[model samples]
Target: MCSNGWIRAHATYYGVNDSPASLGGACGYDNPYHAGFGAHTAALSGALFRNGESCGGCYQVRCDYWADPKWCLRGAAVTVTATNFCPSNNNGGWCNLPRHHFDMSMPAFFRIARRGNEGIVPVFYRRVGCKRRGGVRFTMRGQGNFNMVILSNVGGSGAVKAGAVRGSRGKTWRQMTRNWGANWQSSGDLRGQRLSFRVTLLDRKTMTFLNVVPSSWWFGQTFSGRGQFL
Candidate 1:
């Protein structure tokens, strides 16, 4: 668990019939299923969601009890990645209910609960290091000389605190501005050369990925590197 310790929250799932299951949520991820993304994704409430900046953050959740004690998982827990927003004012929404809440994926919710009790379950959860299969992923956006990059597939202190970029032909590294959520923007044009990026995790540790973006990279394309904060 993260330094925040175990927090009480309500846990629910979005089954195949839900929008998040059929179509991706607000985070822009297309495939979030367990077979696709390993059933490790979740939608967090506004209290802990941090807008979209919480994307990639990980949490460890345990089903302590449901309507009946038999439905509990006996403390077995599952780690889920933050990938969408759970709004607060949508009638049944609990995103802003003065406490942290997690609307987990169906597979993730079941991982910590007994069968047939998949509805609302009482949970104890906390922030934790994200264990991911690959290194970090960088998605390119924007056009011309400007660059807007979205960082994902992050592990460990899952959220990025800062980032920098350098062009293959440029002599110095340039810092990127946080546009919103996991997206960052570089001030100058990097269209003519391959780009290298330096990322800093929320834990204050930093890493440099050299030449991760090819010179011929196009807008809306994504590239993966071989390093992570974990």
Candidate 2:
């Protein structure tokens, strides 16, 4: 890590300018546009992905103009959300293990580097708080006794550490386990009851979204909470 809190890393671009490829990613945010991340997103390397734990995290990245003036746009930077993973390649890839890399979307890359230099550019990145417009969202999935909640539009730390769910008929909250990426799963049958969710961030701050999901909610529907983390 750099003395200024920024860590030295490298960045590259993928997909076209704000294409569909940058939408649904490993983070389970089917459409980043509706998920509140927009097109400013990136696929993190293994070093930073932390086995999907780093999903929904935010980072501010800037090109190191001093290192490569030709490709790096002077004093240019962009903030992006972690939405996907860049798997390591055996053929000596930049996203290989032990190396921190950000495979940014083309639009996000153009904000910190000139066009045509889509390969790799030295950069400095630092974790930052995510600023979301609305409250946290939970997209309901699965059926019957199995329920998966995909958390999104989270603010503050932007990464969930733990989650719990409670039906209107029950006073106890069922602990949710990490299924994949930002998705948390609960095996309890919650059908025909209003749903409430409690989310805990890495900072240990917890928030309870009371009755965010109505009793009529379906598998493919999404519900928004009334509050957000600061």
Candidate 3:
């Protein structure tokens, strides 16, 4: 991290690999290689440092995720990182899951995930982890009840739709396109369908879009999705 003036660097310079097999003899220029390329980014980076192994000499501090009220309306872009909890099912991890594509004429929707319980009152925001029918239920914990909700299919047109919230008392409210919640689940069925959607704060007032689904994401066994913050 950097402040008015700050600096950082290598964990320990194992120095350089001088082994003959390591990009050696000035004849392997065509073949570029990195150690443990197969390991997770975190694991791979950590792999190189052993015994006195260090993650990154001058590392950065970070949070898994967070939300900012200022981000909601300050032209901040909301990004949704989708991760299917169960990979055996059709859902893929964030990087692999299909970006819910939709036609301009077709209505878009939101999928909030809340996997815990802590009596969370629903307001609207870039991300919400509410329960849903397409899959498992939403999770809640302290003020985080409504933290991970995300909007989908939002575009150049600034239009908003309000539909009755669906799901159990503590579940995500499914806002339909025409105030009709009945047809919510039975809508068009497409693995690659793109829907028109946008991210809004809990009040359903302040809103923005989480850019687009990322082509790739840092992963763990139980990663989550919805519009993400900076």
lDDT of each: 0.77, 0.90, 0.20
Candidate achieving higher lDDT, 2 or 3: 2
Question: Per-residue lDDT of 1-230 in model 3, one digit per residue for the tens?
Answer: 23433222111001124322123111111111221111111111112122111111111211112332221122222122111111111112211223211100000011121223121111122222221212111111112122121122222111123322222222333443321100122122212222222333223443322212222221111112343321
lDDT string, candidate 1, 1-230, tens digits: 32458877878777756545334465655455421246668888888877677777888888876434787777589999887888876326666767578888777878988778647788888889877677788889888877898788887878888899999988898999887666789988788689899999888889999999888999988898888668
Judge candidate 1 at residue 95 and give its lDDT: 66
Q: 184 in model 1: Cα distance from truth in Å? A: 1.9
TM-score of each: 0.87, 0.96, 0.16
For candidate 1, what is the TM-score? 0.87
* Poorly placed runs, candidate 3 (over 4 Å): 1-186, 208-230
Worst 10 residues of 1 by lDDT: 28-37
Lowest-sum lDDT 10-residue window in model 3? 101-110
Q: Which candidate is the best by lDDT?
A: 2
The backbone clash count of each candidate, in order, is 2, 0, 38
Model 3 vs. true fold: TM:
0.16
Name the regions of candidate 1 deviating beyond 4 angstroms: 1-4, 21-24, 33-37, 66-68
Ranking by TM-score: 2, 1, 3
Candidate closer to the true structure by TM-score (higher is better), 1 or 3: 1
